[model samples]
Target: MTDQALPRVVDQATWQHELDALRVREKAATRELDAIAAQRRRLPMVALPDYTLTGADGPVRLVDLFDDRQQLITYHHMWFPDAEWQCGGCTSFTAQFTRLEFLAPYDARFVVVTQGPIGEALAYKEKVGNKMDWYSTADSPFGADMGAGPGEGFAVNVFLRDGDTVHRTWHTDGRGTEQLTHTFALVDLLPYGRQEEWQDSPPGWPKTSTYSKWPGSEDVAAAYGPQGVSA
Candidate 1:
């Protein structure tokens, strides 16, 4: 590592003082996030049509995705037909989530919905070693209606089940989905902070093109093998 990349060395007292100052801002940011979540909870929802999505076992209704749970969270995975691989960002983002049994206590179920065919989607999921339940919206308007139409992009959506009725509660895309992944959160704690050009890191710290460090589809494919699970 270059000398310029290192943080300035200081006495223990000075280090603690600087850290304490930073902690104050961090705490404030945490509270601000809580406030924003409160607002999200208060946001109104829209009732959705009875769109049917394709699962491994034939057709399934939108409300069926809840799996008897009151709430549901779905990751709208991006798909490129006839492409050798899928979106690297979407692949890496979705890979971070393995076991989601924790959501059961909250009365919620998490799954993936893609714009690809069910057979292809399931094959990709197997190749990537993803364990989450996946469904395809290729024949339905579900993807377009949920802002994840063909070539549009990836997104995270939330829904509420009221008896047989389903309502769209919330949706987010871009960096908004970062909160769902621990990879970015842990990387942000490093000195380089993703080492991306967009980050406001200390001068002289190593930097590269935005998301340049994210693993590619081939890398993921090789790591997991044709049918191997992620290590």
Candidate 2:
């Protein structure tokens, strides 16, 4: 590596001083995020229709998606009908969540809802080795209602269950979903960040087109193996 590609060397004390200053801002940002979450919790919710989604076991009501839990978080995976491969961003994002049993103790459950048909959705899920329970909204208005309609983009939704009734408490899409992925988080810790063109990086740092280096479906499948993708 060239010297221009690396951070300038400094004495230990100087390095510690810079890091301490950054830590103050980092802690402040953390507190701001916590405050935002607190505000999110107080936001009102809207009631939802009892939409039916197709699962491995066949038609299942949206209310049942919670699996008896009071709260549910669903990732609306993007789909390209009849295509050989699917959205790599969606695949990679959803793949990070391998085990969500931890949410069970918090009285919540996480699942995936896609615009593809049940059979094809399950097949793709298996091919990528995802472990999260997946359902299809192909036959229902659920995907459209959730802002992930056919040919559209991906989304993350939050819901609350009251007996047989359900309410949508939160929804986010686009870059807002970045917080759910560790890949970006870890990469951002590096000197070059994601290497995406849009990132603000020092001169001489390597950069590429946005998402040009993101793993594709084939890459994910190869890494995880058939029926081995953790999430």
lDDT of 1 by residue, 1-231 (tens): 656568889999999999999999999999999999999999999999999999999999998989999999999999999887899998877776778999999999999999999999999888776778999999999999999998889999999999999999999999899899899899989877899898788889999998789998777766764644445
Candidate 1 stretches greater than 4 Å from native: 1-4, 226-231
lDDT of 2 at 46: 95
Q: Compute the lDDT for candidate 1.
A: 0.90
Per-residue CA lDDT of model 2 for 65-178, tens digit only, reads: 998999999999999989988999988888778889899889999999999999999999988877799999999999999999999999999999989999999999999998
Q: Give the TM-score of candidate 2.
A: 0.96
Identify the runs in model 2 with alpha carbons over 4 angstroms from their true place.
1-4, 227-231
lDDT score, candidate 2:
0.91
RMSD per model, one decimal: 1.5, 1.6
Quantify all predictions' global Cα lDDT against the true fold: 0.90, 0.91
TM-score of each predicted structure versus truth: 0.96, 0.96
